[model samples]
Target: MPTVSDFVIRRIREWGVSRVFGFPGDGIGEFDGALGKAQRDEDGLDYVRPTHEEICALMATAHAKFTGEVGVCIATSSPGGFHMLNGLYDAKMDNQPVVAIVGQQGLNALGTSNQQASHLERTFSDVAVYVQTVLSPEQAQAVVDTAFRTARIKLGPAVIILPHDVQGMEFSPLTPENWVSRSSAVAPSTAICPPEDDIKRAASIINAGKKVTFLVGHGANGATDEVLEAAKKAGAGIITALRGKQVVPADVPFHSQQLGLLGSLPSYNQMKDCDTLVMLGTNYPYGQFLPKSGQARAIQVDLKPEQMGLRYPTELNLWGDVKTTLDALIPHLEAKTDLAWQDKVANEMVEWENEMEAQATLTFDDGVNPRRVFFELNKRLPATAIVTADAGTTADWYGHHIRLQRGMLGDLSGRLATMLAAMPYATSAKFAHSERPVICTIGDGAFQMLGMNELITVKKYMKQWQNPQLIIVVLHNNDLEQVSWEMRTEDANPVWSTSQDVESIDYAGWAELLGFTGIRVRTDDEVPAAWDRAFATQGVTLIDAYTSRNVPPLPPHITLEFAENTGEALLKHDPHTVEVIKDTAKAVVTEGVERVKGKLHIGDDDKRES
Candidate 1:
């Protein structure tokens, strides 16, 4: 005899899930009860409590992104369920193996309606691989199997909606047959590599180019090593999307700077100069930064065939999982270029870095030294340390800085930049490894946008992390960092942040109050010391480094929806930005439609947008 809760928990363990990142509530009683008993059991796993459910999902997204395993997160009904949506959208957008478990009020309580009652399943259906509600123990087991399958086959995040009453209910001895998921039911292949000729043709282009450049994206995470080697053979330069930056080592000579809005100015400048531009593992959409097909040969290799040439036109298209294609291409390619090319790209990369830090407005000349903090921490951190960044200007900065050491960043992913995604994503990243130190780089303004509270998961799930510590170094540029700068550059009044009462709500104090080892870092020296204490002393730590919020507005900066002054009379904001964003978005959307017409990435995803 077993219970739905037992089956779900057991299923979680079977999938190698040792840590679960989430926030629970009164609505999830029976499920939580099972969680308690399981934890008490000899084999029970860890429930990772995050500062917020949204953070939990994003954390789960990162954990999944890096490991290719199903990253799991949980949250309660109503707003909590809604809270997880933002990060799930990120996971789905980036195709990470993420699974979100949501607690429900009661199946019977539907519309007959209890407090906090809301449409949880309907809310998440489109964003998830599959959205389901459990009714019986049989359905519970089925959902568990579905959860595993959804994560693996769908290639994105999935939501398993659980009814509280069914969680711990007594059930008859269920045979193992129903528990083992059928592979066909979970994962269905949606795309394929181009024909044999396509691969050879692309490989030929790679072997021919004297100066080849790679614009790597999130899709290219695990294949960095292979891509680097290929670059070595071609004497090429490799650049990555901000999210994909960590995959390549900072010290790699061929590792180039990133491209797009908020990327290195030099790389953006190099777009027109390269002889051949290669797009790998990334579906970077900014056309302004992409290489021009007429000027440079553009080649694309991606996991999905349709991904090639969606934004930038491609001269040669090769479709295969990055690792697989690299294996095949290495044998096909001949040594074409010399080490001098990688050296030149590497030099340009260094110059770009110096210029970035020098001109950056985000530096703490007043008192805080963000550049120093990031540089020093990056130096001391094991090339292996995983960094989760919240979307804001800091993401752009972190994008510009913080390259991982060799092989350490093989698992990290996600570039659909959004804020507060870092807190929980790091919470999940650290939790996934438990002992692995996961650091979150975020801005104070961005943190206020979401899950600034899931820190409790630190104390609640202490036993899971051998150290159970999360080190969050907040780059607090007191002004509405991006907006204020936008105003200054354009000569308009900055809409300074009303995000939080910063004086009243000191984040370091909140971390301290939450049983964390909070350290306020007002100067540069304290940044490393705080990190040392955080790593050595244990528990969670918050290093509040008050930085200047003068960083450049990350490009693709919002299409100003409202009246915003841009120097001359407060005329309607720049229409060009909106038009570019719309055009970029449409190119992607149009590509999808064309693919659906030709049977591309859509599978059994039944959620209808129309």
Candidate 2:
């Protein structure tokens, strides 16, 4: 008779799980033994040990993000299982396919206040799409099968709570009918498409507008060429949600970069002024940035029917595969000839590009500008580089300054906005597509959050790297700069303890000790040279850069209240730099207005009704 743990591990492999990331602990020895047996047999899943269980879960989520396959991770009972929640929530929010197998204390220990005791099924319920506890060997096979299927089909985290004693019990072998199947029952297809009449109505709305714009998201991944074709036929200017940043080529004539706070001025202009907005496969949450009621007639296309018009009021909603729906709608659209809207969007795009270049090159005489780091990295980025940015000030630079070229992949936090995900995401990207160079940008505060221990995971797998250029660029500003700025702008408070006056950590020394080539950069001129050295290194490298904490991540659309609060906070803390802050704010606003004034007819009517 086979042990329940052996059956579970074999079932996981049958479901095409090649690797499992986890941290080893007590009460899970039987499961570990099963994994060990699989490895020895040369037909089982490979076990990857990370320094922490949270990092393990994050690596699994990122694996699914990059590979479009279900990611697998495991953890021991109680505290170890609880540590996996943050990463599992990231997967849940980002809609990635991940399955976490948590070892609970012995079945006999239930409700007895035993050591490492936990009600894991209840604890994992909210974070998982499907949660189940295997109470006996009779239920192990069905429970494990359901966990894998639910993860891939629902595109979120699923959990299997395995008890220590249950996993050790002898079990009967599974028959052929109990084996895993490759095909999914819940994937997108034409059968899930909306009614023909709804698609026709959407096409009519699009055809009626003279100035239409397309807002796309990650759901349009496989429909790039079709989307471009539809945009050209409809004469629509294109803008993307952050997740869809690289889904369409940014260099296209009608493309206007991303929208919302971490976006470009041209994108804001297009979304606000268009007569019709064609939303494709994106549930962009910033309703304030989108066109208000009666401003633009909206049409939405999405695979999920419930999400079709939840973000914005829709005149017509088409629910289907983006590629298939676009194929049907294009034939019904009238070929557009008006270049007025296109020219207006194009002019703003040029100005935005020029403004970005100016901002990226602006450096203080004293400290390194973090924007310049992104500029230099963009210049050195390979066409196939996979870039990931942690949530913080570094994300601001990565989102705005970095230009993802063709064949490049940009990994963001999406809805989670969690810190310390960048390095793990990049590490998984390296393993999933080892031929591509992987770069992760993280702030010093974010680096210390959960990323410090994960460097060992990178070093552990460095021998298998195909690119030999796994670079982790640390923006060593020694402050929680983003949170500090938010405290001032959002709450009208001083920087407070967020910007602690602590001594800098020796990040470069730590990296060097972990078998990585570490380079510390304090000057702007060393930025590009440091990147050159990192790419030339044989394995993992960390470029720890000391940047200024005073430079703020300026918003594309500045409000009077924000400016006022920021100025007041500056006066309270650093009175000497008030004028500098004012100048920076004014320069960005003035440049943006001048760029789009000609197209928007800003001064054509001096009839000031107010």
**Residues 362-396 of candidate 2: C-alpha lDDT, one tens digit per residue:** 66654687888898898888889889999978878
Give per-model TM-scores: 0.79, 0.92
Error of 1 at 13 (Å): 2.7
| Ten-residue stretch with the least lDDT total in model 2 | 601-610
lDDT of 1 at 16: 72
- Stretches of model 2 off by over 4 angstroms after superposition: 173-191, 498-503, 574-610
Local accuracy by lDDT, each model: 0.67, 0.81
Best by TM-score: 2
Error of 2 at 479 (Å): 0.9
Worst 10 residues of 1 by lDDT: 601-610
lDDT of 1 at 248: 71
